[model samples]
Structure formats: C-alpha cells, structure tokens
Target: MILRRKENLSKVEQKHEKLKTSNMKWTTILLFLCFMGITMASAQQKTFKGTWLYEQGEKNGTIQLDLYQKSVENEFDMDGALCFGTFAFSDGSYYSIEEVEVEGNKASLQQVLDTEMGNFKMQMTYNSADQSIELSTNGANGLPDKLLLRKSDIQNQETSAESPIINEVDNETSSPINWTSIIGAVILIIAMAGYSLFIINKKNEFDQVYTTEYFSATRRSNGKSPQSSSEEDTQVTGLLDKLQHELTTFQNHTSGASYLVVLKKKQHKKCAGYLRQAIEIASTNPEILHDLQQYAHILANSQKRLFDGSYSVMIAAGIATLLVGYLMSDLLIVILFAGAIAVYYLASFAPQYLILNKVANSSHTSTGFLGTLANIVGNAKVITYIFDTQDTIDTITGDNIYRYDDYSQVQASVFIVILAYLVTGIGIMYIACWRFFRNFIMH
Candidate 1:
C-alpha cells in the first residue's frame, strides 16, 4: 500500500510538470501574436490622404494633399507612398498633410475650392472619437456644419470597384500611342527646316534688292536735293551700305543650318551695334537719319522675330525628344540620350530667361529713377548737380542689387541642376544594373 501511494504521487507530479510546460508554450505564442497585432494596428492607424476642406471667416477653401507611401526604412507612408517623416497627433487631432503649418495638434489650411455657388473656403475640424468632421466658415459665422466621415470616406473608392470599362479607359488614356505628338514632332522639324531655308533665301533676295537699289541709284536728280558736301559723309554712307550687305550675308550664313541657335544671337547683336552707329553718324541729316532709323528698326524687328522663332523651335524640339524617349523606353540608350538633351536645353533656356528678366528689371528701375529725378530736380544749377550725383549713386546701387539677385538666381539654378542630375543619374544607373542582372539570370 505504501509503494502504490508513492507511485500515485510520482504520477501526479509528472502530469503537473507536463501541464505547466504546455501552458508556458501557449503563453509565449499568445504573447507573440499580441505583439504582431499591436504592430499591424499601429501601421493601419496612419493618416489617409484626400481633399480636406476648411473655412476662414466668410471664405471656404479645399486643401488637396497628395500623400505618398514611404519607401525607405525609417520612413513612414504619409498616404500611399513612403516618406521620411513621422505622423503627429495631439489634442484629439491628427496632422498628416504636407505644406500646412501645424502647431501642437491644430492645422491651419487656406485654399480656394470650387463649390456649387462658385469658390469658397471650407473650414473643417476633425474629431478622432466618432471619426466625425465639422466644417464652418467665417462667412457663415460661428454656426458650423457637422459631417460624419468614416475611414472609408477617405479611401480610394475607384480602387475597390471592379469595372473593366474604367480600367480599359484608364489604360487607353494614360499612355496611348500619342500619334498626334509624333506627327506634331515630324511637322515641327519640317517646318523649322523650311523656315530656316526661307529666311536664308529671303535675306539673299533682300540683299540683292538693296544692293541694286542703293548702289545703282543715279546721284540725286539736280533740283531735288543738295549734294553731299563732306567726303567723310560719302565714305560713311558707303561703309554703312557695305556693312549692311555683310550683315545680311552673315545672318543668312549663320542662322540657316546651325543646330546651336546662340550663333544667331551673336549676329543679331552685331546688327544692332551697326545700326546704332549708323544712326549716330547720320543724326544731323533729316532724310538720311530717317532712312537709317527705319533700317535700324527693321533690323531690330527681324532680330526679335528670329529670336522668338528660335526659342519656340528649341522648346518644341526638347519636348519632342522627351516624348520620344518616353514612348521608346525599350531603347534605353536613346531614352538616356533624349533625357540628356532635354536637360541641356532646359539649362540653357533657364539662363537666357534669367538674363531677359534681369534686363527687364533694369529697364524698369532706370525708368523709375529718371521719373523720380525729373520730379525732384527743377531748373536750378544746385538741384541739377544734386540730381546728377544722386542719380549716379542710385544707378550704381541698383546695378549692385541686380548683380546680387542674378548671382543668387544662378546659384539656385545650379543647385537645382545638380539635384536633377543626381536623381536622374541614380535612377538610370539603377535601371541599367537591374536590366543587366535580369539578363544574366535569364541566360
């Protein structure tokens, strides 16, 4: 009987140990599952992306926030795309959108939104408890309109729907064959070539006409005008005529077939300089001066027209190259080449635009300065001296300001170009590596 009791006690002890082990295993698994659940819940609690409408006093506006999912480690998805930022939630409110100032837990949003009545600012307050939002307007006073919005309301409704028609439409529209763009590119190339050729031929024709009309003219018929007295006058007129002929030839030669349009710019500048000199030399003679000014005006106008045309053509070409690159993505080399070309053109144009803007600002400042000086300076000698001194000082100061602004703009442009190059170069290199790896594995 003692041996049997001891055996029963041992058996009970073994059973209890087995039960304890099983309980521990289950407890560990349960804890692991709970941890996983908490992580998933945290991820899901992130902010949703959509249009947030808000109101200010007597005005309504809509703030559209496009959120991207975070792609890199240490980054969280703001909307669908990953971004390197953490979500901020405080005082019963959450802030997730970009470009809005958030203080504590409150966000201030001002935007112009289209409404049925026209455009208005729609002010909204978000409450996390009931997933409810309230909208009010300063226009509508303190009486706020309440809206109950669930998480589903901000979801991408289209993504949930299974509609073949919609999918087909999107596929067709988003990246269609772009035959129109192709045709336009071809037409543009042809038109540019034709225009350049026409300009060359027209300039040649004008030169011939001008030479024959001016050089072959019989000395002013006896009674009509006084004879040119100074030998210098005759010599100057002859030089002017020769210079014009040379300019016409230069324009025709340089502008006709060059891929680099800047050559044409240099020619235009030369023409302007010659015209200015001719006007200065012939200033005293009415008829001669009139003719010279008219000729100068013609040259100026032609230069402007050509400059504008060239700018348009270059822009079109850049766009065409980008489009072709996009369409012919299979040819990676060609795509890269096109991208480089587009970037080059962009860089060139950016500088030219900056120069033009600078010139315009300078002109405006000069005009304002002159106007102010004229208003302040009377006929008095002392006033005149003061005006001249001040004007000179202002000119120097204005030039310094312009130089600083230009330098800043140039620095900004350089930074932007560097950033673009880095991004594009990395992307291209990654694609190349990926392709190489894929090909090697396939083989």
Candidate 2:
C-alpha cells in the first residue's frame, strides 16, 4: 500500500510540470505576435520625417529637433532607420542616439547625452501624428526634468550649403558649354523636324471622306449615265466646292496662323471657340463634316505640339547645365542649376495643363506665354537662392535670426550664362518647329 501511494504522487507531479511547460509555450507565442503587430503598425505610420521644437512652456528655450531616416544597406537585410538631430538645446547638451525602436505611432530613442552637469542616459518618445516629443531620463544619473516638444513649421530652419569660394575663373572656363549637349540638342532638333514632317505629310495625304469612291459607287448602284445625273451632279458639285472653300479659309485662320497672330492671353481657347461656332454653321454633307473635324483636330494638335516642343527645350537646357556643372566639378553650381531647371519645368507644365483644360472646353482664361516665362524665371531665382543658402535664416520675428550677404553680381552672371544656354536650346528647337509648321501651312 505504501509503494502504490508514492507512485501515484510522482505521476501527478510529472503531469503538472508538463502542463506548466505547455502554458509557457503558448505565452511566448502570444508575446511574439504582439511584438510583430507593433512593428507592423509603426511601419505603416512612417512617424519620423520632419522638424519638431520644444514648446514655449518647456524650460528648454528655443530647442529644435529634426528627424530623418537613413537606409541600412546589406545584401541580406535592407531597411531604413530613424535618426534624430538635436539643435540649439538650452543646456548646450547634445545627444548621440545609438538605437531607436518604434511601437505604433510612438518611437523610443536611447542615447548617451553629455550635458553641462554631467553625462546621462536619456530616453525619448515621439508621436508622429501629433508632431510632438516627450523626453525623460532613466533615473540613474540622468536629466532631472521632463520636457515636451512640438513641430515648428513656419519658422523652420533650412540647412544651407557651404559657400563656395569664387576664384578668378573665367565665365567660359567656369561653365563651359558641353559639346556633347550641343550635339545631343542638334540630334533632338533633327528628330523633332523629321517627326513633324512625317506627321504633316500624313495629314496632307489623309482622305477622311473618300468622296470620289463614294460618288462612283453611288453611280454604279443607281446605274445612271452621265446625261441622266449631269444636272443634279453639277448643283451638288457647286455646293461641295463652296463648303470646301469655307473650310480651307477656316483652317488658314486657325492652325496656319503665326505666333504673332495668336498672341492673346487665351490663344488656343479662342481658336477652339471659333471652330465650335463654325461647326454649328457647317454643311450637312458627310464629307464636309469630316473635313471640319479633321481641321479642328489639326489646330488643337498643332498648338499642343508647339507648346510641348518649347517646354521640352527648357528642360533640355536644364539638363545641359547640370551635365556641364558636373563635368566641371562645380557641385554648388550643379545644385542651383538643378533647382532652377525643376522650377522652370514646373512653372511651364503646370499652367499649360490648366490652359489645356480651358481650351478643351472652348473657354477663356488669363494666361500668356511671355508672362508665364517671366513668372517662371523669377520664381526659379527665388527658389534657387533659398536652396543655395539653406542654413541662412531671415525672418520678420526677432527670436530666430541669421543673415548672409545678398546675392552678388557673380551669381547673376552665372544665371545669365545658364539662361543663355536655355535660350540657345530653345532657338534651335524653335527653328526646327517653325520650318515644319511652315511646310505644313504651305501644304
């Protein structure tokens, strides 16, 4: 009886141990899932990509925080990580974070900070959507206070490029026009001319109505001799002639007109409106209606092509500037040149799209080509200046202020050289386009 009781007690103890192990396994799985969920949530938010500042109420005065991401490049593991930069801290202390972990919208930062008092282990939490940050210490020889930070969008400090020393390099030597770009530009112009000629030839030869074939088929179907249909055919031919003459006049007025002729604020829109009005008064003949449609299409296409070609030259000029600067080892010039090109393209394309929208509806809008170009050039200058001098800050408020010398004459000369490059490209392309359209008009 004693042996039997001892065996039963040992069996119960083994069973309890097995149950505890099973429970622990499940708990581990659940914890892992929770951790993965948090990681996924943080990724979805992309919580660290801008500037944050300490609020006015915080003891730290005029502290700025900027966070950005850098990618870790490894053959096996490719991922981006968050990095933080602390600027203008009150205590003149700075942090160099070693690790960052994100949980949902909040991110935790671990950093070793050296302050006036002493070195401390600091912890930070960032809330992305709220654009706020909370800071504390680990309670072991750390910061004595907690603080909050908010995003400062308006008075944001821009990082500026280091000023380049302007030595006595000749303008031509500093920014030599790349012969490769010139060759490329020449080839592009030739291609544009070839394509335009082909299109114009195709347009000239296109017989949308097949009037002769239709007339012949009609004669065969009716089995009518020349005498029988002569009277009716004469009247019909006269009417067709009159309609054809009218359409020719309309085409000449619209697509065949010169740039000087259509220098209005809404050139395409006005032309399209006139075409629509002509459509309403057009002949009922199927052939005449088809011709009208073809002419209208030609006008729209010609205008669109001219604008597209001009804008493309502007972009090409920008590309040329970039290439030349790169080859010359002028990094600052390259950046400014790239910025100007970007601004120029955006200014050209954006308004043109709006104008197209207006033209499509045969409505008028207030936009002109020269005016648009002027605005683009002006805006590009301002943007390029900001980009070149990012670290230099100037504001109406007295709190945060930094100043640098105004744009000098050398910069202006550099810009002129850039502009000249653009204009040369435009001139080449414009000549090609003009010749193509002249031939089209003659046809």
Candidate 3:
C-alpha cells in the first residue's frame, strides 16, 4: 500500500512538469509573433528615399526630375522646381505625400510626380529589386512609363567599391549645359502667362453676357409699366388700397406668414446696426429671446456676405496674378498669384455658394410668434451651418475656392485655350535663344 501511494505522487509530479513545459512553448510563440508584428510595422514606416529621374514622352525631350525620401516621413525635391515637406505611410493601403495630402492604396510614387504637371493625372508602381519607379495614367490606352534609378545612384556613399562616387578630380568638367533647354523653359513660362491673360479677358466678356442675359430675361418676364404717371398713379392708388385691405386680412388670417416677414424685416434692421442698445436691453428684459436670436442670425449672415464678397475680390486678384506669371514666365509670380487666388475663393466663394443653396432649400421649423421670429432670424444660420458642415473647411478657406468665381473660372478656361499660342511663343523664344547661345555666344 505504501509503494502504490509513492508511485501515484511521482505521476502527479510528472503531469505538472508537462503542463509547465507546454505553457512555456506557447509563451515563446506569442513573444515571437509580437516581435514580428512590430518589425513589419517599422519596415512599412521606412520612407522611399533617393534621387529619381522624371522622364515623359521621348527621352530626348524635356524631362522633369525629382528627389524622394529613401524611406517614409522625409523631405523631397522636385527638379529645382519645388521642395515638398515630410511625408509618411499611415497604413499598408495609403500614404501621405506631405503631412497634409493623403493617398490611398491605388497611390504610387509616379502619381505623386505627375501632380506637378498640372495637366495629367498619373499613377505609379515601385520596383524594389531594380530600384526603379514606373508611371501610368488611368483609363484606356494607359501604357506604363518606366523610370529607373539604381540604389547606388542615390544612396549614401560607403567606403566600398559598390558605393556611389562623386569625383571632384575634373573641376572644369561640364556638359555644355544645353542653352536650348534653358531657352525652352523660359519660353514655356512666357507662353503660360500669355494664355492666362487671354483667359481673364474672355472671362470678363462671358460674365458680362451672362449677367446681361439674366437681367434681361427677368425683366422681360415682368410686364412693362405704363409711361404716364397721372394714369399710373390713379391705378396704383386703387391697387394700394386693395393691397392695404388684403394685408389687414392677411395679418388677421395668416398671422404666421405675416409675423415671419415682420420678424425677418426686424432682423434685417438689426443687421444694419441701427438698433439702440437701450431698446435691445428692454426687449431682452421682456423675454423677447426670439428677436435677439433673429438679430444675431441676421448679423452673422451679413458678416458672412461681407467676408464672401471680399474673398471673391481677392481670388479675382490672384487669377490676375496667375495670368501675369504665365505671360512673364516668372514662376515666383505665378505661384504667388495662384496661391492668393486659391485662398480667397476657398475661404469666401465656395462657402457662400453652399450657404445660399442651403438657405434656399431649408424649411423653417420654429412655430408661434417666437418660432416664426426665430425662423426668420435663422435663415442665415441655416446657410452658415451648411458651410460649417463641409468636409474641408481649409479647402473651403484655401486658394482653390477662388477657382469657383465666374471671372476666375472663365479666365482659367480661356488661359487653357490660349496656352497653345503661349507654347508657340515659347518655341520661338527657345529657337532664338538656341541660335544666340549656340552660334554666337559659344563662338
């Protein structure tokens, strides 16, 4: 009996040891999994950095160049044209080009560069093995354009034969720095400016026509008034008497509508800032909260209108600047103007349009005298709310908003049309510069 008890205890000890071993194995596996997940996330965070060649169309023609981050969250340079801020890969599906601009899974390296063209939208694919970036546009007939750069071409120099070398041995070594290329670039700039100017002129014409047509159509819909004042006055007096009677009837029967209109007029009067503070205080004491709400709404709306109009004007100025830049081939000028135009329109024009639409469509919900007063006062509130609800307040406040202006939009359209002419001008300038530099200056 003693031997059997000892044997049973030994078996129990063995079972506990076995369980402990199993637990350890599982713990090891869980740790390994955690490590792998962390490593993967870190690797993904690595920026794609290097100098890249931007080739479009034939290789012999003008080509753009760019410098990108070796990994994620770094700065990049665009062929002496533009330098972008830091970028990052937020998830496996998308990345941010700069801290602000985000792109989805369909986003690739080449698409980023194509944004500079300001004309065509493109996509990109990266090749890790060859260290190359390829681009393609969307839609039918989309052919991939391959741009290759070896890791050695852009990576940090190592103290080994495989590392990229920058030789300063030949101080005078130069590649004739193509005068034709410089000339071409200059001409292109000029042409763009000229085209922009043309667009502005065209936009003015279109706006004039549109405004005239709108007013004419409206006037025609309303019958003309009689020329004789004496005859008209007699008819008008009778109509006025009838109107007075009807208004009295409306005040009694349709108090809601009449109250609403009166409330609206009062709100407008308050917006004009003619209301005495003492009167406002008395009204407030009487618990005329509806009147106060209406006043506030009107004031807010008026402020918005003022801001929108000012912004529209600013956008117009920016468009004008863009036109000037296109004509002058001054990149700095163009960028400044374009930027201003974008900011004004985004801030004022776009929000106003949205607000106007909302106000026109939205229905009043408030009832009774106070409700009707609130409804009347809240007309502007509805519009302002719509503006606030937009997905991009910055975009609404940014330079892109100026693009919505009739004049600006028209000008931009015209600029595009006149771009061909500008291009021609640039070509001529290029040829002249090429001849002067190659034939005369070189000799």
Candidate 4:
C-alpha cells in the first residue's frame, strides 16, 4: 500500500511540472508578440521631404511637400501631424500651400487657392520612390482634372551644371517678387488708359461744339432775320444741328466703337452749297460779300478737316512701333511713339502754318505778321526753340508770367502734356518688365 501511494505522489508532481512548462511557453510567446507590435508601430511612422513637378496641358507647376513628425503619436500616424507644402506655377506668378496627410510611401494632400478665375481645390497623392505626384480633382473649369508630376531635382541639377554663373547671379540679385512694383505698374497702366480715353473724348466734344462767332456768322449770312426756335435758323445751322443729331444717334447705336462716321463729305458739300446760296442772297455791300465769301470758304475747309483719319493712323503706327520695338529690342519704337504724339498734338496748327507761310512767301510779304507767325509755328526747329525758351522763362520767372504768350503757352502745354504721358507709360512698362521679369532679362 505505501509503494502505491508514493507512485501516485510522483505522478502528481510530473503533472504539475508539465503545467508550469506550458505557462512559461505561453508567457514567452505573448512577450514576443508584444515586442513585435511595438516595433511595427514605430516602423509605421514616416517622413517625406522633396519638391515635385506637375504638368497638365499648359498648366504645369511645382510643389514642395515636406512632412515632419510632431510627436510620438504623430510619428506613428503622419495624418495627425502638420505637413508643409507649396504649389507654384511655372511663371512663379501665384503660389499657395496647406497642411497634408501622409501614410506609408504615399501622401494625400488637400488645399484651396483663390485665383483670378475662381476658387480652386487641389487634391494630390505623392509617391516617394519615383519622386512623383498625381493631382486629381473633380471637373472644375480652368482647373486641371488630372496631373502627373515628376521631381524637379533632376531637371534643376542639369540646369545648375550647365549655367552655374547665371544661377549664381539669379540667386544673388533675384529675390522674391516685388508685390509693390507689380501693383503700382497695373494701377498706373489702368490710370493711363482711362486718362487717354478721357482726352480723346474731350477732343471729340470740342470738335462738336460750335463757337459763338460761328453762330453769329451763320445768322448774318442768311437773308432772313434771326427768328425764334420755330423759324428755320439758317441752312448752316440746320445742317450742323442735323449732323449733331446724327452723331448722337450713331453714338447711341455704336457706343463702344472706336470711330463713327456721322457726316460724310457729300453732306458737308450740300451744306456748303446752301451756305453759298444764302451768302449770295444776303450780299448787300462789298465788305459784307467779301466777309460772306471768306466765311463760306472757311466752312468748306472746316468740313473737309472734320474727320481727319490721319491722326488715327499716326497713333496706331506709334503704338504698333512701340510693341514691335519691345519685341525686337529696339529703342527706336519709343522715339517713334513720342514723335507721333508730338505730331498729333500739333496737327491742327501745322497744316495751317504751312499753307499760310507758303502763300505769304509767294505774295512777297514773308516778313509780315502772318508770315512771321507761320514761320514760327510751321518750322519744327522754331517750335522747339519756342518750347525751350518758354521752359527757360518758366524756370527763371517761377510764378511771374514773363516771355510766354497765350500761343506759346498753348503749344508748350500741349507738348509737355504729351511728353509727360509718354514718360508715364514708359515708366509703368519699365517697372513691370524690370520687377516681374528681372531674372529672364538678366540671364
């Protein structure tokens, strides 16, 4: 009986030992699994930093995406942290950035930018191995639907090796864009355009307005006494009124057009014929007849001069020359524009001066008042001299009016205003080209 009992005890001890061994094995496995879980969690955290290029049609751009760990928690999950990124067009005109999310070898980012077209929402995914990104978005007009981007580093590396000196210069001189200059240039351009249109409209208004002397002459030419509104004013007055009405009608119809022809030479010739008949009927004395004839001749000439398309051609040529000059790298375009403006401003006086001077010289009275005035006005050199003298007088006398007469003031003022306009236009363009495209120009 004692032997049987001892054997049972030994059997029980073996069973206990077996149970202990099983518990130890389970503990080791659990510890191993826990260690593996912690390692995997640490390994899951990642950071990516690089520049990426994207192209879709004409809309190609660069994006700099950099993801940095914020904390242990964020280290494990990049989406919980901040990722800095910037997107810029090829021209470097507009740029924007926003926080992004990263996981494994891919990162998903979302950003919104306010542009001239409208608001744009950008969604992108990046692959670290290829240094590429896929930009995807829903159908948004003016915004890319899908874009593929490769790293710019490779391209930049090739460029840097080829043009180290140019790159160095760019780095030293070309900093970030000058926002002030850009804004100023745009504002100046708008202001210049508005002012130029205003000037042109003012000139048109002047051309349409008849002087008091002209109305008096018209009334005198007609045989009938000047009557109230109901009575027919005069043939000249009626024709002018008709012309004015037609102009208003044309203006109303083609308000945005550059030029409108309301009265043709045929209409003006009819007016002249009516005026001549009226003058013949009203001719009572030799002096009155002579005055009436002179008035008729002036009316005919004025009608012929009303719509001088030469000025338009000159202006168009000047502007075209300026644009072509800029493209061709010639300063002659600037000179051409300046000269054209000068000619346009002095156009009214020039033809009169030339004709009057020629008549006076032929009549052998070239030294008389009319001859002297014509010579002074017609000769470009004499005009330049007068302008210079007036400028000198202005500088020396300050506020006190001295050598400059009404005629001189008119001429000088016109020239100076045109010059100022040209200078201002050039200055605006210079600021735009220099500030915005400095790198392109310098390199």
Winning model by TM-score: 2
Instruction: Choose 2 or 4, whichever is better by lDDT.
Output: 2
Model 4 segments more than 4 A misplaced: 1-49, 55-60, 67-83, 93-122, 126-131, 139-141, 152-443
Ranking of all candidate structures by their lDDT, best first? 2, 4, 1, 3
**Which tens-of-lDDT digit does each residue in 1-443 have in candidate 4?**
45446546855975776575456434433443443354345334333445577776676776555433211111222264322444567654343333344445555444433234244455656666675767775544454577787877543221112211111111111111222223333443343333323323322112232334444444444433432233332443554444434331122223564322323334444555555454323323343334444444444343332112234334444555575455545453355345434433323232222232244346353454233444544653322222333334455556333333345655865565455444434433332222222211111
TM-score of each: 0.23, 0.33, 0.21, 0.24
What does the lDDT read for residue 115 in candidate 4?
Answer: 36
- By the TM-score metric, which is better: model 1 or model 3? 1
**TM-score result, candidate 2:** 0.33
* Candidate 1 local lDDT, residue 72: 17
- Candidate 4: C-alpha lDDT: 0.40
lDDT by residue (316-344, candidate 2, tens digit) is: 55666655565557655454445444333
Report the lDDT tens digits of candidate 1 across residue range 32-115: 344345435433443323434444454443323322221111113334532212122222222222222222213333332221
Ranking by TM-score: 2, 4, 1, 3
* lDDT head-to-head 2 vs 3, winner: 2
Q: Highest lDDT among the candidates is held by which one? A: 2
Model 3, span 78-106: residue lDDT tens:
34222221212212111123211113122
3 versus 4: better lDDT goes to: 4
Count of backbone collisions within predicted model 3: 26
